[model samples]
Target: MLNLDVVWTSEFAANKWIMPLPADAIPTDKMIPATVNAATYRDTLVGAPYYTDGALFYFRSDLLKAAGIAARPKTWDEMKTACKAILALPAAAGMSCYAGQFDKNEALTVNFSEAVASAGGTVVDAEGKPTVNTPEAKKGLNLLVDGFKQGFFPSDAITYLEEQGRRAFQDGKLVFLRNWPFLHASLSATDGSSKVAGKFGITSIPGTDGPGVSTLGGRNLAISPFTANKATALEFIKFFTSEEQAKKRLALSSRAPAYASLYADPAVVAKRPFFPTLLTSLNNAQPRPKVVQYGATTKAIQEEAYAAITGKKDTDTALNDMQAKLTELSAK
Candidate 1:
């Protein structure tokens, strides 16, 4: 959008694009750093971040308590062990161990990126180099592919996106779910649609060695360059990203605010008890490979990762294929 002249840019603290922002527009000292970095392209400010999002682990606390599990798993290996114990219980009969967004689309790209990143591998480097064939990459890929082959995740999870995975967990079909923050409010609501309300808990996604890296996901507000009223656009942007609106977003929908101080506010913290954990997630999350050809790059990722997960291609073959294809797209 920046390259095509599709949007009007803003100067905000989180601006980091190659396009420069207006001087002395907005001080971004209160916004989260990772979000700012993600919006920045070549040191220019082009967008005002609205909400920041990252992957979170949701699980049945009651199931863990019954399985004699002492706490949430800190690592993927530990989570695997916990899944095994929990699945053995009679109450957990017909239940799958875990679920995530793995359908062959953009969600799969995010899921695959997190797996590789959690194992300390990069799909593509800052210089647009594909790096998906290393030992760390293999370790990460196997965690999901191997798990699928061994029945850790249901074979049907090969078709789940956010809604499908959310429904599976909400219907009490899965023990653990990996999703973005928006699901918290929906699942925790007092309404009758939620079957697991108040029966679950949230935590960081488990990593190979410890906490995993989350693929940053959120929205940034930008005005179109063709807008007739630039001043009005600026005012709207200002009001939308203000601290007051940030608090409103959080309180109304469990939406993570772009401002950092809101995470520490007594009222905000009391309403969203997991703000600290969310802050940590945002701090550690990495944006998707910052390429202009994002659609092509992510399609390359989804194809190979989906093939690997569904047994159509081996992990070694899938990663090798993905690296070659991404390298080709990056060069263009």
Candidate 2:
């Protein structure tokens, strides 16, 4: 039986449960721990990275070839043109990538933040202030709205979850898709659930200025300062993060390791062909703002910014309100 209740650190800052983790057992980077963001870097090395994953662009190769383009776009402008060209085809239904309805709350914020990075922007200004209202963010949102208006983006995406959008691509309607690395297991499953498996190509989300970009936050295992099993927890971290054990854990679970090494395995590379491209993207990846209030700020952007783009609200009014909201949020 499980020793004690396991709650996401995001939900509870200090959890008390079970003994320390086993020597070879890996920690959950995305889910485990309590406030590793504030705990890991400042207080101590509370958790070590296991395997990690992030946003990867997946597309339909057959469609690209038919469109007279054989290579994946290495630039955002090219990506936009590719989207438009694909949308113009007789098979055009809509683009079903992460550009979905902006639902899935936290994930969407992470998604939007990633978009900002791709455009060579960031969530906070250099002085440690939120920059969601900056011109780059505006440019990024305008691109989303442009697609939404052109019918390349779905009207229902605002309501769809990541998995919901993932399954939708199987409808054979989407020309492209974006998701975390976990799809390697699901997409290749022989369960007969996916229609486009073995049919789509994967790449990085081409960057607007340089190449492409991916957000970087891997699952980490951290013991709550309140945990009674500190020894066991430390032991577990050592084992799980071990180069040997990480490879095994990754084979068994969807969670990725945080190390920069395990990515070199032939098996890992073969399965995730876009791995190399994603690594390059990772080099330029930026972490989310360190503030605890990041979660709330992102929510405001989704509900407000996405609404404006989806036609639920006017851009000028929505953006003005966003600026006011950020200003108010910062003052507090």
Where does candidate 2 stray beyond 4 Å? 1-46, 88-98, 189-192, 330-332
What TM-score do all the candidates reach, one by one? 0.90, 0.78
TM-score of 1: 0.90
Q: Which candidate is the best by lDDT?
A: 1
Q: How many backbone clashes does candidate 2 have?
A: 16
RMSD of 2: 5.4
The sequence of per-residue lDDT tens digits that candidate 2 reaches over residues 6-38 is 112222232332223333344334322322332
RMSD of 1: 3.8
**Per-model CA lDDT versus the true structure:** 0.80, 0.59
Worst 10 residues of 1 by lDDT: 1-10
